[model samples]
Target: MPYPLLHAKAALDELKLAARSAPGIMVGVTIATTALANVPGMGDAKANWNSLAKALEVEYPNLIGNAVFLSRAGWIADDREAFLNAASVFSGDLQKLSGLCYTMEGQVDQVRDAYALYWMEIGLLAATVLGYLLACQAMKLTPHLRAAGEILLARLTLLTNAMIAQKTKVLYGFLAVAGGTLATSSQSLGQLFNIQPTESAAINFERAVIPTDPPSVYLAPKRELPARPKQQQR
Candidate 1:
């Protein structure tokens, strides 16, 4: 029988759905960090935070002229990155992205009713952007580690999908391979327990053993502690 167009495409439908939903997991974090990026003289975290209370002061001005805007139009879109990008511009706090205190402020908010919230969003976004950039840079620069991460991620995806399908035999096979490889690597650092061409498990069972060695850190420090009496008077 010929496959229908929809049937051929259904395999990735769940993955696409999951990807769409996963973006929300980080949305709150982005929004929160963006708000914190906008406060002025924001260094010395303690001082910045103290001033932030005053900065956050949103008073009723009907149509105030000195207000700050964190999310645009009194609110932000659900897309965290876009919201953060806007907040950074609104506060003029890119330096905050470098872990430095932002000393700039914008007077674009006409309501004065939202300065506090705007200030907060800018601060939060600055921190988050810095963190994201650092993480992305590290991941990009480290290829071996990145490969290891990808392998682990692939295994997780496999496990999740397999578990849902109840194909436990495949899961068990994967576990066996993983466990055996790890066991082999751990048990044999040199030539002893490694599998050899003429070796049989029945004949090699006795050779599997770990060596005993004094850990380097446990060596005497060359300084002595005074001895305590074995028993104290009751």
Candidate 2:
């Protein structure tokens, strides 16, 4: 068995829900953060909330790209060290990104109880995404949340979904831009792993020839009479 396949699979299974809900979660977090941005003491920290949200925007695609790389790496069944090391490093990167969210959430909470609660919900969303990466790295799923926590998470999820439903066009535009970013990231990751297109999928870069001829051709007329006259004189 590969080193992390089973673990990664399990974590992915768990994360699928989170991944599907990320946009809504981010929308909620954005609304909450914006609401609290003007609160006392949050002046310096306002940007952090937006930054965390922006970071999260790339996270889903990053995970998907990493999963593709991991799968390709597994199939190739070579360079385990490189793959595992990259996975380890990538997991740390995920954790660090999550830490930024966690910190911003904490700072928001410090300003007011309502803001704190709002951010705690955001933290839960962060945990759902980052927790899976951590689980993949440790090969152990995090413990389930208590009943109360589950209820709150569910409600927040519902609220975010409703908000998303009301703002489809905006989310669509955001996702379009995100899709472009994901393509770039995926391309870089493919290069890192030396991933190539399958035979059927390979591109033909050879230039095509366009057959054409000149519109007209010109030739000098022979001076037959002059030539005859010169021979007669000779």
Candidate 3:
């Protein structure tokens, strides 16, 4: 019923997420955009931002407009108008939210690929270095192809497993953080909708803030302050 608060809360959520992921996202986008921009005459680095915005607009073009219309039509509460200023409650914000999520996932995948690739490359580089070292140590100066190959394979497997474990830990940590956020947001939403915690939580909140006198004080026989004696009539 209170549309402004509802929309404000949603917008606030996007803002918080944006703030949280901003640093990593900036790194990812910088790397990604730089990588993408190097392709000669691609001419659409910004296209991603536009495409995402348009996609969101397609989904919710009337979001801000309708919220405005609702306010004018006396459908929403007065206090809630504060949320729909000139800039907010629009598809752009949602798209930003979507883009942030998309870019984050993209970055994670890129990093994963890079991690695997780097480890694989490290194994190759190490093998090459070790191979050269061995060749130098040899009297015949010919590398042992089979022995080097075996060592490389064994090292590669071990490195891959270690990387996998690290990635697994990261993925699980992401899940835990994501899950906890969702749970908190859901709890907030339930508070909004009166779906969870029943009446007791609110009552408890009130009691905590303005606590009742102890039961004994209320229950004990009260010693009333002596009534002011009536002034004698002149």
Candidate with the larger lDDT of 1 and 2? 2
- Report the number of the highest-lDDT candidate: 2
Q: In order, what lDDT does every prediction score? A: 0.38, 0.49, 0.43
TM-score for candidate 1: 0.17
Tens-digit per-residue lDDT, 135-189, candidate 3: 4335233455656654544554344335434544564566566557556644643
Per-model TM against the reference: 0.17, 0.24, 0.27
Worst 10 residues of 1 by lDDT: 101-110
Clashing pairs in 3: none
Q: In candidate 1, residue 38 scores what lDDT?
A: 30
List runs of model 3 lying over 4 Å from the truth: 1-143, 195-234
* lDDT of candidate 1 at residue 127, scale 0 to 100: 42
Cα lDDT of candidate 1 equals 0.38
On residues 94-206, what C-alpha lDDT tens digit does candidate 2 reach at each position? 55555555555554444434433443444454456555434333332234544544455556566544553434344345546655654664465345456567797876668
Q: Top TM-score: which candidate number?
A: 3
